[model samples]
Target: MTDMPDNIVMPFEIKPLGVRGRIVRLGAVVDDILHKHDYPAPVSALLAEAVALTAMLGASLKFDGKFILQTNSDGPVDLLVADFSSPSGIRGYARFDADMVAALKEPTPQALLGKGHLAMTIDQGQGMERYQGIVALGGVSLTEAALGYFQQSEQIPTRLRLAAGALAQRGLRPEAWRAGAIMVQHLPRDGGISPQPFDSGDAPEGSKEEVTEDDHWVKARLLLDTVEDHELLDPMLTPEELLYRLYHEDGVTVYPAVTLERHCTCSRDKVGDLLKSFSDDDRAHMNSNGVIDVTCEFCSTHYQFAPEEVEPAPEARAQAQ
Candidate 1:
């Protein structure tokens, strides 16, 4: 097996076709996040896809902000949360019932998720309005749900493919989890393609211009449809090589890739502050054997705090000292 490079998100465009897209290849970063949770195989696979999707969408932010992808469902896997911070920080976690997962003979990712709604939110930091889109999820994969979101919410013609699995050396135990995704959007410079319908109310009385899909976009999407799951997950093939295979006829131009890493924004101090937010009676019940234990779902970092430490503000305790 060829050695795969570290995680990265590469931006590329088929200029001749008026289409732009991003390709993300995740390696150790994704492996670490999945292994940290020790989730069952099906759950891990689903979460990995969510991570890849989150990274692809978050990388498009022009400002220093955050993009969050969350899903609430009525399946074995009840919830999935993944967020990407500005530039290249990504973290994710999944909530599932182990017994229900194990009881399944074989479960596809969509089956594991059952029925739910997927929500994507963008936070432009403090003092800025947030934008969010929600789409119902059932009888479809997460990729399809995301496409529906873009179609209904952004009204943009988009195509996306995602893959994730455990890769191991020949005749050995599975060592790592990897995920990859590619997304393409139709964006014509001359505004030739409008996904929205023509507004008859605003049109001139005698005008009869009807909107239709652009040929370039149709060709670009057809080309993207040729991508295979193995190609996306193949460590041997670089993102550039994959893009060439798909868009070489149209001459693909690539921009600098954005390196990504796994990072959790959890800390002892933060957990302590969270504990202090509870009322005195609540804190009392939480003080089990003289200490309260908190574990971060994203990173699985464990923290412990004393009751008195959280009761009074640190500054007030210092004054009393």
Candidate 2:
């Protein structure tokens, strides 16, 4: 096997503003997620974007833990979950109907997701309190909803664009998929908790304070407004070059990349444990005749445990042991 760079989570920092961050690029991991199911083209694309966005946001977590971004909707494409952290990874499946087809017209994010809630969950690993932010979904796709979440809930100034599909010449159903994304956020210019800068820049357009924080904010906003989806999503452009193109003069600090892999928290024993949540009748039915095989919907990993191996944990033995 050829050498592989260590996929360690090396956090990237903005030197000038003293603002720090991290970015996880998804590749091998994304394919594993997509292989879990035969999702419609549009649905798969949404999950890919979800993977990048979640990793991007999760990298900003300050402590050792996992950040989960979940999209739960009442639409045809129902659920999307992305897990992110040091061993930063992505594995998730969409709830596409059996009749779904890949040949359908592509959909805007909101249309594909339908009415839903976007929730960001932060688990700090230690005894620290876990935090969650839930915002009403907005915008045409996952990118738009994420933008709304950042602005309305976290109040952090952020911009994100993502795209997912097979390599152009490879066709849409290729075993290897390519997904790309770019994330940008305005560093805390004043300070992490400093007061807003652009409060009164609207002073008659001629007042000295017209160059207030508002003016700076306006300028920043205008700069981001010029970014196109193609630039962020294109696989041909290198990530650093993409940044230079967007913020060359604005002083963006490039950080080392973290490799995103395919990992899932599912196991046969774990699945059995979950089965314990069901009634005995259900469990009996599940293992009535022979082995019950489980293929995780996230990574398509197949697991089989014979009926004899599916027994419930013994409460008394647990206490004694």
Q: Best-fitting candidate, measured by TM-score? A: 1
User: What's the CA RMSD for each of the models?
Assistant: 4.3, 5.6
Q: Would you list the clashing residue pairs of candidate 2?
A: 109-141, 110-140, 197-213, 198-213, 198-214
**Mind giving the per-residue lDDT tens digits that candidate 1 earns over 162-227?**
999988855334567899999999887776653544444777787857667778888988889999
- Quote model 1's TM-score: 0.90
Clashes of each: 0, 5
* Tens-digit per-residue lDDT, 1-321, candidate 2: 534332223344444443444433455567667767777667777887788777677666656789888878766676778888655555666676534333336466766677879888888887888888887764457777777777667666665666676544455544565565555455666566322434334657555443233343445445556766565444455565655565566566765666666678887768877665555566667773576666777777887767656656688335535
Candidate 2, residue 128: CA error in Å? 4.2
Give the candidate number with the greatest lDDT: 1
- Candidate 1 wrong stretches, greater than 4 Å: 1-4, 170-173, 194-212, 314-321
lDDT score of residue 14 within candidate 2: 43
